[model samples]
Target: MAKGAAKGPTVASLKKVTPENLASLGVERLAELLVSVAETRPDLKRRLRMELAANQGPEHLAAEIDKRLGSLQTSRGHVVWRQKPAFVRDLDALRRLIAERLTELDPAAALDRLWLFLQTAQPVARRFRDRDRDGAVAAAYVRAAADLGRLLADQDPHLAANALIDAVAADPEPWAVWAPETLRESSAAMAAVALKAARGRLGGAAPSLAVVRALAQAAGDLDALRGSWSLQALANPSVAAALAPQFLAAGRVGEAGEILRAAAPQPTGPSGRLPPPDFAWESAWIDYLDQAGETAAAQDVRWASFERTLDVDRARSFTTRLADFDDVEAEGRAFAYAAAHTDFERGLGFLMAWPALAEAARMIAARPDDLDIDPAQAELWAAQLRRRFPAAAHRLLRAAAAAAFRRREFKLCDRLTEEADTIIL
Candidate 1:
């Protein structure tokens, strides 16, 4: 407070060094500083040349970017992982030049340059095959390829659709990037072309099916999509199951049911047990039955699914549809069925998941021969049950710890044993 005391610098006296702040240093001084820095940093030197070219006009900028892209395309030195970050950053900078700056000045010219930029992907990719194990280089090229869609957006749809398809058909590795939704909105002719290309590339393969499905859905001709699936394709349960929901959405309920029935495993030998259930196929069939208003049939499937698989979702679906008192009765029956399932761990898991802790406790207390608990799930289930049924929780923890010991997981065994002791205490 003394009159002679010096005042400390105030907040306003300090200046952050930003472009605006640095401008006070004036152009000549800043230019000298950049020249000195550029002498040591080639990347910064290249960037400076780019900025200078851009200031001259977009044509100049386009020329500068093309030169760099050409240099990258022809080069083939292996880039180790340590150099990948800088390499990817340089590619990204070129992408921004083509996508953001050059496009604003001359769109047609930018479109040509963008295509050239994408051509560098393959060469750039080869340089890092063993190096970029994390896919950084490929991902950078994918981003650059995406700009083709934006550039083609305002062009004629027929030409645009064909150009896009041809580009993909030529280098189908980046097929997904070229799949613009706008092409789907094109005429049925374009959809037909896409379907043909899809079918031609790899017959009945999943990727081809994806292309056909997208085009057919857009054109409202799901039958064409279905027809693309060969008899061989339908023989794969997963392929048949994949098409069921699309048919359901189109209200082709009978066709949906027919395909699923045809795909279901045929009655085998004397047992007639069929192979282990394909749950994905079962779920699709249940959906189809529900859509067809086959309530009683659906209920049978749901209950059967629960009994065979001890699936909690199936049990809930089966019991939830019964009349009020009927639901309570069916629930008890389902619980009893689950308790008796052949797979003891699965049965116990179903009870615990249903939080029917009392039943779960009783089941654990019985100590079935297959009493081992899954080590991963044991800690969580034990935590939930410990307060309500300490003895049951302790039993599960001890069983899990014993299993861990058998697996030579000594640390886990010790941890679980300590947890079991705490549960009983």
Candidate 2:
């Protein structure tokens, strides 16, 4: 009240104006602040307008949403990489407004608008998805798709099923992946409707097989799922491998075996004789043999896969299944096989990961020139082996340093050389 007294800090300057603090400023002041803030922040302004529309009732909110959705639908501007962040943020905000806010007031309108948004957004999303290394834009669409699924989950099963059928039938890419969860929450009758609709879309380039398999799995109708796969489809090793597990789980070992056996290897290479090995089919067959009580056959498949592929997982699976002393013997054989493997790098990697450090050391000493050591892997190996296999660790670190030096990475090379020096015997 004194004229010469220093003025106290105003309320805006006294503390950070968080939501709680801003609320204390009272509705009138807050409204003015919002308007001032909205003058510069378009996103916040649009959100406030939507909230205001919502106050007028669902119809008014629905009209605002329709205008927004129509604008998005007509948007033709390509969202370049630099524009992606704002594009994703705005799209996600619209998705949340429809899903979280509008749905509560008018569920049917929300669902319809969401479908419209998805249909409008998917093509643009798919265009950018390939170039989206971090997948921010694609993730926004996934969240939208998942929101659609959750909304469908709340609808009556019959109506929800029809909505799902129509969604996938229109654009199946991202939607089909989320449909199974909705289908899972639906009644068997709903699942049947979904499966039947998917069946009609089969071989029509709609990724309908995925939908069929997903629906059948949800409905527990393995028969329809099996019949859904045409012979052409079954010939693809992955398809056969996929169907085999369901049959095996049902104790139809013969059918499982028959399908796996019927699966043709995907031909590759100049001669076409060297078909890329179907590791999935091999694993499936091992599983089928094991479940059928053919332990010996399963073990043979496991060992063969290990030998042919040098896949350490198959080696582990084989050795784990062997009886006490037999495992030790099998492991010895595996070690020898790895040491003599045609792919020197793979063989050495196998030995190193197996913690056969002595063997790895011997391999390094024997074929140092053949080893292509990753610097990080070499660092880990050196740290692990320095106390015991100093010579091998020295060799690995020097090799990695040499690799780095050749690539003109002087800093990494110097760092590695220093590390290697500490291991000199």
Q: Candidates' TM-scores?
A: 0.76, 0.80
Query: In candidate 1, which residue ranges exceed 4 Å CA deviation?
Result: 1-57, 89-114, 131-133, 141-147, 150-153, 176-213, 269-273, 406-408
> Worst ten-residue run, lDDT, model 1?
177-186
| Model 1 per-residue lDDT at 113 | 85
- Residues 74-142, candidate 2: write the lDDT tens digits: 766666787777777877888898988999999888989888877766556544634678877667666
Model 2 spans > 4 angstroms off: 1-36, 55-57, 122-135, 171-189, 198-203, 264-276, 366-369, 403-412
Residue 130 error for model 1, in Å? Answer: 2.8
Candidate 1 C-alpha error for residue 51, in Å: 6.0
Kindly list the per-residue Cα lDDT of model 1 for residues 1-425, writing each as its tens digit: 99899997666654776676689899999999999999987777888898899899988988888889889889989888777788888888888878888888888888888778877877888898575678777676666655766676666656765665666656654554434343433455565555655555544445544555666765567788678678877866787788888889889999999888878877688987778558888989999999999988899989888888888999998888888999989888877777777777888889988868988888888764667778878888888889999988888889999999999999999999999999754
